[model samples]
Target: MTLKESSGVDNELNKGDRLDVPFPSICFFDLYTLKVFHVLKLAEGQYITTFALNKDNTNLLVSTADKQLIIYTDPALSLKVVNHMLKLGWEGDGLSPLIN
Candidate 1:
C-alpha cells in the first residue's frame, strides 16, 4: 500500500544520478488479498501528452491523439466509458477550439 523504496530502470543508477529516467513499474496493493501487483512492458512509445492522477492515486486520466481522454483504474485497463465529442474538421486551441 506504500512505496517504501524504488529504483530507476538503469542498473548503474545511484543517488542523484542525472539522466533521463524511466518508470520501473507501477504497483498496486490490494487490501483484501494483501498482495502487491505490478506490470512491466518493455517497449518504446510516444511521449505522454497529459496525465491526471486522482487525489488518492486510485484512478488516472490520460489524454492523447489530440482529442482522446481515457480514464483508467489500472494502468492497462479502461475503467469507464470515455465519451468523446469531437468536431470533424475543427482547429484552434484549448477546450473550445476556434473553427475557421
Candidate 2:
C-alpha cells in the first residue's frame, strides 16, 4: 500500500504578495489489488513526511510536512467485530464470511 500525491489546485488563496496554493493531494493505493481506494486533498499545500501503521495494524498514522499527524482506524477490525468473528470460529487467515 502507498500514499501518492496528485497535483493541481482545487482552489486558490491570495495573501498580499504571497499566494498560498492548494495543489497536492494524498491518495491511498491498495498494492495487492492495484487500485486507488481513497484520496484526501492537502488544503495547506503540505507534503506527507511520514506514514506508519500501529503495532496492531488497526491504526494508520500519517504525518505531513506541516507538522500535522492524522490517525485512521479500521472499523471492520474493531473489538466488537473481532469478538464476533472469534465466536464464529474465524482463524484470521481468510476473509470473514460476516464481512460483507
Candidate 3:
C-alpha cells in the first residue's frame, strides 16, 4: 500500500519521520484463507523496496526505500519440538524440562 499522503518532498516514502506520525503497514495473510496472520512492523513511513521468504518459511528478509535491510523470524518455528507424557497444554509440568 502507498504511504500516508503528505505535502511536498516529505510526501513520498521514508523521506521524513516523526514519532507522532502514523505510516502505512504491511500484513501477512494465510494463503489458503486469505486471512491476515501477521504484520511486518517496518520502520515508520519507509516503503518496502523488496522482500523475500526463506525456503523453509521460517525467516523473512526485507529491504526498505531508505536502504534499510531487516530480517524477521518466527519464534514458534524456532522453538524446540518435544513430546511430553505429563503435558496439559502449554503449562509447564515442571518435569518436562528436566527430561528434555
Estimate, for each residue in 1-100, the C-alpha lDDT of model 1 and write its tens digit. 2232343354444455443334432344577974655443222342346778888776767665455565667533332212122343333344443356
Estimate every model's Cα lDDT from 0 to 1. Answer: 0.48, 0.68, 0.64
User: Which residue pairs show collisions in model 3?
Assistant: none
Across residues 32-51, which tens digit of lDDT does each residue of candidate 2 receive?
A: 97565776667564777888
lDDT of 3 by residue, 1-100 (tens): 3345443435555654433322545686689976667665666657888989888777788888888888888666565433333344454655453453
- Give the RMSD in angstroms, all C-alphas superposed, for model 1: 14.3
Model 2 off-target regions past 4 Å?
A: 1-23, 79-100
Q: For candidate 1, give the lDDT.
A: 0.48
For candidate 3, which ten residues in a row score worst on lDDT? 80-89
Q: Local error of candidate 1 at 57, Å?
A: 0.8
Q: TM-score for each prediction? A: 0.29, 0.45, 0.49
Which should have the higher TM-score, number 1 or number 3? 3
Q: Candidate 1 at 62: error in angstroms? A: 0.4
